[model samples]
Target: MNITLVLFLIVVGITLVITGWAARRTRTTVQFWAAGRGIKGWQNGLAIAGDYMSAASFLGIAGLIAFNGYDGFMYSVGWLVAYLTVLFLIAEPMRNTGKYTLADVLSYRMSPIPVRSAAAFSTVAVSASYMMAQMIGAGSLIKILIPSLDTTLKPWFNWTILGTKLDPSITLVGVLMMIYVIAGGMVATTWVQIVKAVMLMGGAILLSFLVLLHFGFNLGGFFNAIAGVKDSKTGLNFTQPGILYTYGKTQVWGVDKALLENVSLGMALILGTAGLPHILMRFFTVPDAKAARQSVAWAMGLIGSFYIMTTFLGFGAATLVGKSNICATVAPKCTPNSNLAAPRLAEYLGNSFFGTGGGEFLLAFIAAVAFATILAVVAGLTLAASGAFSHDFYVNVIRTHLLHGHVSEREQVLVARITAALVGLLSIWLAARVGATANAAALVAGVAFVIASAANLPAILFTLFWKRFNTWGAVASLVGGSLVTIWLVAIGPGWSAPRPGWAPNRSLRRDPVSTRGERPAPLPYIFLVSQRDLVGLIALDVACLLAAAMMLRAWRRRRTRPPLVAAIFVVVLAAVATVLVLLGVTYSLVVGPTFIVALLVIMYTARYERRVTQR
Candidate 1:
């Protein structure tokens, strides 16, 4: 076998062995879903980091920075800051109340029917969306590493119709993820996540140090290399101040005002973090509320460090290696894809730091790590979705008839495995159809926002401080919020075609029957590419507002509850809404002041939540 293939097989084998060892102890439904509830604070924290940081972090962020400049950091900022909401509000309460999944927390006050049903729906939606993104990323990576494999293996492995080639890599990723998740469950998934997290962070840190050494460990020299490139057309240094602006720079915030844009992106980050099912399920595996709190603290540290390193990696890509090399090695065919930039940078620096042979080896190592990163994350996602399906849907809903009050441990595991396979197939199908669309990131972000705003944030906030939060309110908030978010995203700006003046067809001749035999003047294709981000933001805001209103009206009718609980609910909803609005506005405006204001708002919200809890 080729060395690369052999190396990849070895890595896969090691992961499987470790996963098998972990699965040996998972003999019960509780153990399968929650790792026997004995995981330590720090260990679970690291695993949370692993579960949260998928191919999106390793490949997406750096690629984004390479393409979007400073704006790419917005993703990192949004992702990291989102954790604060989790730390202050969601984690401890979720741990204290829930036994297995998010349904446990939301259904605490009501019938298991609505809560479990909503939990299952939201879990499947978000997990599927997130899994689709990872699958797309994995398919893209495989195409890059072994370009010829697609052609050579296509006839045997892939489906094709009418001369169009269908991608099989998506199916491969989905099947592999299913195997690991079904065989081992959360116990196996958690340990794999921890190991992958360590490898990813270590690989990043090592690459950063090697890049620095390549530049003689001089920060100034690195910037100098970047800033020295002059644009031939403008005679201005490409990397120097005002260079982009001088060339009639397109709006960095892309159609929205700065503040609205920042806030819109921030809303996705802040709320989405709390809503992530895989991350939420991890909290259940811990022993108690205190341990859950500690896990959040550790997750914050690890994630923060990793994000900072990603920023450095982006800089290294831009500085040490020229943009042309990045484009040639990663974004071939002039497609302007940023996802491949980081790996390309690694190859360039690896060759420079080590010999050509060693550099090739290092490149293979990075690829293996990226592959492992995807596998670990997909495993977690599959496990969470499967648990929601088997535990929340089947056992709670369907199999309740057959079990006569209690389902067997073996039955639950079997059902979970079957559900995992179904989910895996759905994700692979979606990824295959979507291919390399520009809206992929936005799609994933929208899912996170929908889940966080609809189910997790409201449920957690009310349960912690509100005494009157009833089953009706929880159901309305969770189900209503999720449905609205999904509807808004479906018709949002990202999916729409641009308005008329944005795109014009230049057909040369104004009149087709001209006697002079001249070409007809171009028809205006204007409005072809104009974005609807502003419209989408407004829609999302209105939907979230409607959700809050439903919850508040329900709370107001409950005369038996403490007045303070109602007051707390109002205060918490207002705080969350304000943060969401600010984030939306900042994203629209794309100004420094807007970002600063949003940050201050987040800080104040954190303080307010703490004070309310203390009272």
Candidate 2:
């Protein structure tokens, strides 16, 4: 039997055993969703680290650094720093207040049903996008290990599956993911994450060590090699910061579009981790506020160390394997794939150190580890999605509104298991239908991060700390932010423009960055809203500041009825402005005004509640 096949079976068998054992104890809602809150801080911390470091961190970031160089390392920086937001602002407060999902926190002071519905929708959306990216990476990695399997199955299952031919590897990955979540629930999922985290950290550490050994453990030599690395096609050193982010022939206020895009990506990443439903859900599995805080502390250390090692994983591939081999300039030659960089590098390093046939063993181990990474992440995402639906939507919304107000523990657990299976199936269909290319997994996951940051972050912060935040503000932030973020992504340069020579399929929609003959397409100006007159931009910013002043004044005199109607008028004005801005207007207008309006609405609602109480 092939080494990769043997390792794959071993990995699958161990996880299944864990699932079987966990299923025995998973008899109630708490066990199914929160692991009965018996998990120790270190255990949940490892799980959080495992859940957070998905295929995007392992495969996608490594490939990005291999190809894009320094620009790719920004992802590592942003993601590592993001845990601060969680530690100081979100983690303890969330555990102290909420039960299962992010909706638990938001629905604390607001109307339960509508707020829960909005939150559930956003959770599902983020999870679906994030899950699709992980599944695609898994399928692509699997295809590499067992290329013959896909070809063998293609003859019988050759019909179009979501417009692209079905690959057996994708189906296989999806089936295993469903099994993990359906059988073991959070208990099984938590242990699987703990196991995978150890495997991944070990693999990463070994790879980094070998890379250092190749350079004779000299930091200067390694840095020099990376600096002198050449682009496969253009021969430019991609190790420079601005290389990949360059926008084509487009400037905003004479500023490079690349800079703006970089900033935008950074903001999304830094804020997104605090808002991720899967990461937030991990907090509930621990006992209390102190456990939650300890877990975050442990996670930050583990996550930081892993991200630091990614520098070695990425640059090692670039210098040792060469970019041309990782992503060939010519068609189909050199095995032309970026997603396989880390595994391929493992093969090379093993051969160099241990001689003939050792490459296969190392490659097999890394491949199994990569598969475990994907499975662990997908399980967490599916659980979070199901929890949102079964707990928030079904129990809180549907049961409260239509069915009887009370729901039994057994019924909720059953509903959650059913929902997990359905969500897994839907994700499989979407991943197969889109046929997302493997190398683009990080960017694909970026879509989820952006949505989470825009929609969930604001709502979470307000609910936890802001005293005046109410149902209307919660609904607006969740629904409005999600819709606007999705719209912006749809029209952005990434999705709207394609490289000149590529086919016009939706699969190739992202602005192509090829080492081949094509250059990136020009960005649409409407998407580059910074090009609006500089004076007008400053004026709108000033107006935003004035709006802040008004909010401060309203806060000081909140008890009086005189400014109550005026606060309502400001909210109405802000709403009208938001409508106009959303209609073919500059994007900057959206952020400042929308935030101001949400605050104003909170103020008005708080005053109204006070008046009603007095009457």
* The candidate that achieves the highest lDDT relative to the unseen native structure: 2
Q: Model 2 clash pairs?
A: none
lDDT of 1: 0.70
Error of 2 at 245 (Å): 3.0
Q: What are the per-model numbers of colliding residue pairs?
A: 47, 0
Q: Please, what are the lDDT tens digits per residue for candidate 1 over residues 1-615?
A: 454566667767877897788768777887888988888999999999988888777777876665444556777888888899899888988898888888877777766776788778878877877777787777777777645544555676576444444576666667777777777778888888888888888888888788778778888886676556544545654344332233343333344245555666678778878888888899999998888999999999989888877766776776655455665344436545566667777888778767687667777777778888888988988888888888888998666744547888888877877888888877777777777453564466467666776666787678667998865566666766666666555534444434222112324322222321342332221222124644544454454455445445644654423333434444454455445434432223222222233333333333444445578
Model 1 stretches astray by more than 4 angstroms: 148-156, 159-166, 223-256, 328-333, 399-404, 436-438, 496-615
What count of clashes does model 2 give? 0
Model 1 TM-score, all chains together:
0.75
Q: After superposition, how far is residue 608 of candidate 1 from its true place, in Å?
A: 34
Q: TM-score per candidate, in order?
A: 0.75, 0.81
Q: Kindly list the per-residue Cα lDDT of model 2 for residues 184-292, writing each as its tens digit.
A: 8999999999999999999999999999999999999998999889765444585677557765544666676788888988899889999899999999999999999
Which has the greatest TM-score?
2
